[model samples]
Target: MIRLFITRHGQTEWNLEKRFQGSKDSLLTELGEKQAGMLRDRLASQNFDLIYSSHLQRAYRTAEIIKDNREIKIIKDKALSEMKLGDWEGLKYDDVIEKYSKEYDLFWNKPHLFETTSGEGYSELKKRVIGSLKRIIRENDEKNILIVTHTIVIKQIMAYFEKRPLEKLWDLPYIHPTSLSLIEIDDEKTNVKLHGDISHLENNVKEIC
Candidate 1:
């Protein structure tokens, strides 16, 4: 069996402002740093055999914060990076809708049919995320693993495990920053025991954009 603890990366200034970050590098806000520290404190007792994170700064930085004094080797993987927003990178939500109405509309309501300009589609992201999961499963053998990644990446990974089509990917609950999701994997089955859990957070904790 394999135990997986998956979390979305901490918040960034763009995230706070509800802007699309895509693959662009963004640093964590002060509140995001606090979130990471809170997570570290909450999960200090949990032992993980392996730690993996997206190559991006935001995700890896969040992992680094949680790692604290632990000696686990951190593995950076491109497969866990956020979706590439292409021309839409760094744009605000409203501007994206006004400027690229067709693309924005399709992305929100019918993601499977939408493709970022010169970028990957949801099916491709699903394939990449599942491929990464396969590799992690084989390597983990029978151990606990932690993956820190972006919202879309986590969503795609969850969709793959739920055996759902890419079109219905967004149907699942939204995964917020610093939220944890637990997965149990056996040779014959993979189960999502929990999703989008923020019980570790304070009552007034700010939501990720």
Candidate 2:
């Protein structure tokens, strides 16, 4: 059996402010750092054969915290980066709606109509993210693996394995920051669940934006 443990990076300033944090990098907040540590504490005992993370600072930092003193060498993959939001990056939630109505409307509520002006297209993001995931699966050869990535990437990966169409992506539960997901793939069957589980955070779980 193949065990795929996927998780999102910790919270950022933009996340707390409800800003669109596409490819733009942001520093993790104090709470964010704690979240990563909590997640690490939850999974530290597991024996992962390989670890991968996005090249973005937030994700890389979370991976570092998770790795801690472990000998694991995390492979930073750009393909796992979050969706680039073009001019929408760094814009506040209300600002995005008021400034870029056409794009923002579709981006939040209508994935089918969402389109980035100077960023990546939906198909492009889906293709690259899944391609990278497939490559990892092929090489790992059924060993347990850990993937540290962004929100959109994790959503897409889960959506793909769950056979959920893009239009229904939001139908699934919102994946909180530092949330963990487990995807199991094998010859006989493939299973995925716990898309946004943060039970590891104890009772101090902050609301994820």
Per-candidate total of colliding backbone pairs: 0, 0
* Per-model lDDT: 0.86, 0.87
What's the lDDT for residue 182 in model 1?
A: 93
Q: Measured by TM-score, how close is model 2 to the native structure? A: 0.95
* Residue-level lDDT tens digits of model 2 in 148-180: 999889889988888888887666677888899
Error of 1 at 99 (Å): 0.8
* Model 1 residue 4 lDDT score: 92
Model 1: number of clashes?
A: 0
What RMSD value applies to candidate 1? 1.2
TM-score of each: 0.96, 0.95
Q: What TM-score quantifies how close candidate 1 is to the native fold?
A: 0.96
lDDT of 2 at 33: 89
